[model samples]
Target: MEVDHRIRVSDGDGETTAGQGGVVGVFFARCWLRLRSVLVGLWCWVAGFARKVGRIAREDPRRVAHSLKVGLALTLVSVFYYVTPLFKGFGVSTLWAVLTVVVVMEYTVGGTLSKGLNRAFATLVAGFIAVGAHQVANRCGAQGEPILLAIFVFLLASAATFSRFIPEIKARYDYGVTIFILTFSLVAVSSYRVEELIQLAHQRFSTIVIGVLTCLCTTIFVFPVWAGEDLHKLTAGNLDKLAQFLQGIGI
Candidate 1:
């Protein structure tokens, strides 16, 4: 009887150990499968991205050239941060030029030119107006300054918003008007907090102008792309095709 009991206990221990081993094996297999799937997904994503870029380059090699131009422009502008002498006195304001390069750089030379001019003019106009508003607010004393600034912001913002509804302005100067509102609000609201508001405005505006100039030069001198020329060519090609079709149809 004692021998039988010992054999049964040994059998139970072996079964329990085998069950635990099976569970561990299954868990590792599942983990390996998940890991493999993740690796395959990453590989697929990289391959897909490469194919798309290659397709784009093949479709229009000009796009790749334009991309290079943008990179070169950004590199040129970034030099402002690297060279101490070149960017002396500008300090952190140099970043504004970088931001300008990012936002103002367009696919076409004409678009870049238009945006750059609009930004410059808008910043200039808004700075002057903000300074004027600040001066008026100051006369009202410290307590009244914030109140007046808020009111100015509200009124100018409202007017700018309303101007967007006008068809003429919407078509021609919408971007400029929007930028003007932003610049004015920023300069006007911060005037009370900043003692040397003029200097601050000057730094920001100067940096932005530098960035705009960088974009303009890079776009024009380095394989210029013109939307107008492309449009003209496309229209001419379509007309030619239409004429050919009409002749073939005996029209």
Candidate 2:
């Protein structure tokens, strides 16, 4: 005789063997998926820090003080990213935007307040374009093939237009490129939600502001690194090596 597995509660039947098997399978699958997601996130975080460390090691000839400075500065600023709610909601976009501004300002703009302002402006502009485009696309019912085509066209146009006008940009085209890629990538990743896109636009700007301020504070408080140092150091090293080579030749 088969067991009557159904338990009739107030509304309907509660559980049968089939339902139990499905629920159990779903539970295991969810657990597996969550574990995988956590593992991947951890891996990426570790890889990012490792890459930062490696780059600093390779670039800093005065490896001791500069590396320590870089590490402490990054750590201090990154505290906001990991510990604050402002950056928490933006997810990967926050990290990408912050890293873009930080790296560019560090190398090109002397990481000053002006560069922070530039980053904030660029980020807001990018968010505006992304959110506005998404809203327009949604209003027009552009999805599937139409959406893809529109995105491709927009990308090509953005590149062409910016390439022509980028000469006047103070920080050059790096900020423009960062905005372009970030806008397109974020739009692509979070597609077709007009309301959500609006929310994202707001969140992106807020997080970017937080990130830019973090960088500004970091640069101001820490031993600020500059790109001219590399040029000066390289020139000095070349001259020293040349003098040694001349002495050896004379010997």
Candidate 3:
């Protein structure tokens, strides 16, 4: 009977099976082979998520509805790119509208409305403030522009952050405030170098508006889930539970 034995490989030997010398080389060669196997089998994971995002996309009816809704919204917004007149009107900035639809579309009407309105109002306010800040920064001259912009960003961002601590603002407008700071910072910084800040802002803002409108329409009209209705139901449920408890005490 012969025993299977590892071949004696030395540091300088060229006869190793992996074509590399010694134990270290053999270990690394085996690890590389294992990594290749993982990469080769990755298609299994990708294929699962490749299901068409249309009506009745999945077994779950709710999930299927959501998928179809999202697909419809995406398709509607994509018209900006497909139609020649719309594409010409918006130019490359049409892409922003598509991105906004993807980002702002939500599962509930309240969620969609909250985010869409927040983003729209924040962008409007930030765009105006950014333009004003840019004008002021311009007067500071090239050397002073960067410094002034940085200072404005720092002060405003800090103030916005502090505002988030208030209970009223935190309950609502939290997302809007965050977006406000983001838009302001981006515009303020970009204005220093980009010559067409005003034009770029206008295009971006317009696209965002379109995106917000699309989200609002799809979430509200397609398969409406009213936030107020949910809140009312919840309140009613709690009242019923309280009444049941009092009835038990009376008995």
| Predictions in order: lDDT | 0.90, 0.62, 0.85
Predicted candidate 3 versus true structure: per-residue lDDT over 65-169, tens digit per residue: 666888998899899999999988888889988888887888778888888999999999999999999999899998999999999999999999999999999
* Residue pairs in clash, model 3: none
Q: List, residue by residue over 105-170, the lDDT tens digit for candidate 1.
A: 999999999989988999899999999999999999999999999999999999999999999989
TM-score of each candidate? 0.85, 0.50, 0.69
Candidate 1 error regions (>4 Å): 1-19, 247-250
**Which of the two candidates, 1 or 2, achieves a greater TM-score against the reference?**
1
The order of the candidates by TM-score, greatest first, is 1, 3, 2
| True-structure RMSD, every candidate | 4.9, 16.7, 8.8
Using TM-score, give the best candidate's number. Answer: 1
Top candidate by lDDT: 1
Task: Output the lDDT of residue 3, model 3.
Answer: 70
Model 2 lDDT tens row, 1-251: 89865443343565334546666777999999999999999999999999998898777644554445446556655665686674566665566545644453453326455556656776676666665555555566544535753675467557745765555652465655556566655664475543466666776677666666666665556566666886798899999999999999995
**Of models 1 and 2, which has the larger lDDT?**
1
